[model samples]
Target: MLSQFMVLFGFFALVLVSIVWINKAVRMFDRLIGDGQPAWVFVEFTALTLPGVIGVVLPIAAFAAAVYVVNRLSSESELTVMQATGYSPLRLARPVLVFGVIVAVMMSLLAHYLIPGSLSQLRLRQDEVSRNISAKLLSDGEFLHPAPGITFYIREITQTGELRDVFLSDRRDPEAPVTYTSSRAYLVQEGGGTRLVMVSGLAQNIGADQNRLFTTYFDDFSYDISSLVSRDVVNLDEVAFANTLEMLRDPEAVATRTGTTYGTVMSQTHGRITAALLCVIAALVGFCTLLVGAHSRFGVWRQVLLAFGLLVGIKIVESIVVAPVLLNGALWPLLYLPVLLGLVLSGLLLSIASHPGVWRRLMGRGRRSAEVAS
Candidate 1:
């Protein structure tokens, strides 16, 4: 059961993560490739996002595999034989517990190390790519949108890398829209900044506030384009990308970089630890729920549905707890409630399954009373 659960979990997680990552990567290709990035850049971006996808998929996969294996065993009567041979529910759960622990360890590794490292590298690569104009962001005879509300078009490119008939539109400031057209232009790299040097050009500005148009023609012109694209790595500093140890050691710094509260950083750091525990809880929940009733000849489909229901309830509780915890750090401990609830429910279900006599007697008494009333 343990081995099967592990194999199934790995398979499902891989398939799920691949589908999700590829879907997202397709959307990214539209933006990144449209900005003139190469195909390899898209591949690299998708690769860097994979660890986070795996981390998100692992726990759910473990639960699903555990439920499927348990249902199969119950349907096959193997679980009944073991029970008749004096195997308690708790005893039968040994393999599942081991499976859960193994999955938990994998989740811990991803949460603490792999995910953070991948995200950090992803951010750095994205920042570097965003800053370099020569890297991408230019194509002849096509309109290029370097940033929001900013567009550039070049009619032709010369052998010496000069631009002929260049047009740029900047609407970053909604109150004033600026348009520049030039007969000849050069993209000059200087002092870690990119500048558009235009010769024999005209600048047109439409001021919405004044409701008027202003135009200027010049022999020579220059526009600083460093602001058009992100030039610094700071643009990539999100809380999800920060190291767990770093968040624990210096939450204040994390808050500053991520534009979030110190409490939010702490919640995120501790949330990773708690999420790993939930993976174990998820496995146990699936395994124990199937032990709640006697073996069914029709198969354990009811128990399978019950197990999924329990998992959904636990996830709902997790979602409910997250908001309060993030809002106030004082409520951070509540994040473990869902895990605790799962563990408690699993223990109760296993206990009941082990001592079916008590449950049978109670049901018998209730049926007898109902008959008397009728």
Candidate 2:
């Protein structure tokens, strides 16, 4: 159990760190979009969607860690002692299978429920930020003050994408509408508010939608726009936010009706179930490998390679199986068969490897007892 726990713990930690680093690297490309936002903003955005990242990386890491720990134990002669004490491969592997079951359930929860909900929230927040009329949208060299409740201006935009020559108008209160114009402007976000600073501008008020337009200009203008309600209105049912109970209650309804090909759905479902089962498969494979001679130089490395190879093979098979299912709805459940087969095979192999010596010793003892009785 300790060995199994260490393997699972180490794998989870490594995968989490790797995911964070990968997220950072992936976000660097966002800077090229020239959104005038700091790279850290993109990083934070990625961080908010990390549950999906965890779902993808956890199974691979678990498989690798299982092989690694088992190999380490085999190399150190600990596995040999356990085997001699009549601890069959199945007995040693039991902890790993147990761990796998736990992880599988957790991952299932994450993939089908938690990740989708979190992603929905992240998307909603992103939409809100993008739609917000703030300093981020201001550009230079454009006559921006087009109408009431609007202000716009432009200057020679810097290569770094900063705004200059900002203008603004506010008709939010029809009774006392205000307008301000400036030669230069900068945007700042603080305390849940977005503010624009205009230099060398003016302020005035014009009549509402009438010929009586009164305008006054100012040398400098400063205004604040609340960064609230920027999010696009979305219906909860349209978003993917089903929890486990919800999914179980209505699995068919939980699936999106985007006219997805049967093959694609099959593939996706297969991938999800396979990922969950990998924990059990990895544990069984590791336990069987541990039954080899402790002093063997290459045994551990061989098992590690085998485990990785099997994992890759499973992924490839899943992709292949899912392709047909995407084209035809009939093949959806078939995708799960490979994962089930892998688990069964691993269990059987572990059982055989763990007890070869035990059976031989028991048979010898039985023969000796029979001869004494005769």
Candidate 3:
């Protein structure tokens, strides 16, 4: 019961820490965009995203907390007393594993379903913000540089989506400068991009020998002012989410267009399976670590650090295994190696914990050191 409480408490604490840390990291990038949005907007964004981060961090943190709590109990000889009262090591490990399984199932749901849905919503919100210029985002008599190489200067923006004393300059062309002026303009989305629907505007072109000018008096005109940047086309299957059954079902249509290889697809599929298995293996590893180090003088912090290191190492190995599938098709089997290594390590830790000789040696070492000091 105590072990279960420790696991639950640790999961929540670690998840909260992960949310704050990730939010802090994302804000640094958000500030660069100069959106003039409040910090609370970013905080809300981070809060909505906490589940995804928790899904990834919870399993590992639960593992570490279990190890720390169990090891501390054993080191203080509390576990010894429990054993004297007929509580077996396996019996102690059961509650920890049960807690780990519940966390694993929850994380699996987040990773496979909830995270993707939240990410899609985030994209839509960003798109809405980008395409629509809110009055709140604008300040009177201040130049706004919302997108690269595009600047807008306005004396005031009215509540009815009208700009006064507006000046627009687009420096995308170095050889020829394009300058435009309008008494009023409104924001609009066209052709998957944002455009300024300027009315009663005149455009001027500056050249070496002469200046070319054009004036238009129309009800409405559209000027391309899109801020959206094109991204490099990476193979979709390389991403973990694309490996889902729903995605794979329409592979012939979607897969070929994504520019991904069969090996890359296979690796991504295996990676998801491996990730689910990792939760179980981490629990085993944590339980064993606690039991083997039961009599150690080191505090829980050391075990926490060690568990974090192990989790990081496992993630690194997972990436390394997937890299081969991206580079060479023949090395697809290498993706399985991380899961195999995790299993082996978990088994080894369990063995070390169970062996009578190993415990005897550890106890003997403590006795010898005490005797020498005496």
Error of 2 at 15 (Å): 5.0
Clashes of each: 0, 26, 0
Q: Residues 1-374, candidate 2: write the lDDT tens digits.
A: 55566656566657675767576657554542344455666666776667777777666666656666677667777777887898777677777777677767878877777776787787676665565554246435555432346655565667665566555556668777776766667667777676776777667766666737676665655576653234446544532443545444444555564343434444555556666776566555555554543357656666566666766776677667766676775666767766776766676556547556776688799999999999
For residue 50, model 2's alpha carbon misses the true position, in angstroms, by 1.6
Candidate 3 C-alpha error for residue 170, in Å = 5.7
Best-matching candidate per lDDT: 1
The lDDT per prediction is 0.85, 0.62, 0.64
CA lDDT, candidate 3, residue 237: 35
Segments in model 1 whose C-alpha atoms lie over 4 Å from true places? 140-151, 156-164, 169-227, 230-238, 246-259, 366-374
- List where candidate 3 sits over 4 angstroms from the true fold: 2-33, 36-44, 133-150, 155-164, 170-243, 247-254, 293-312, 328-333, 358-374
Count residue pairs with overlapping backbones in model 3. 0
Give the CA lDDT, 0 to 100, for residue 263 in model 3.
Answer: 63
* Candidate 2 vs candidate 3, lDDT winner: 3
lDDT of 3: 0.64
- Which whole-number lDDT from 0 to 100 does residue 299 have in model 1? 80
lDDT of 2: 0.62
Candidate 1 per-residue lDDT over residues 116-135, each given as its tens digit: 88888888888778777865
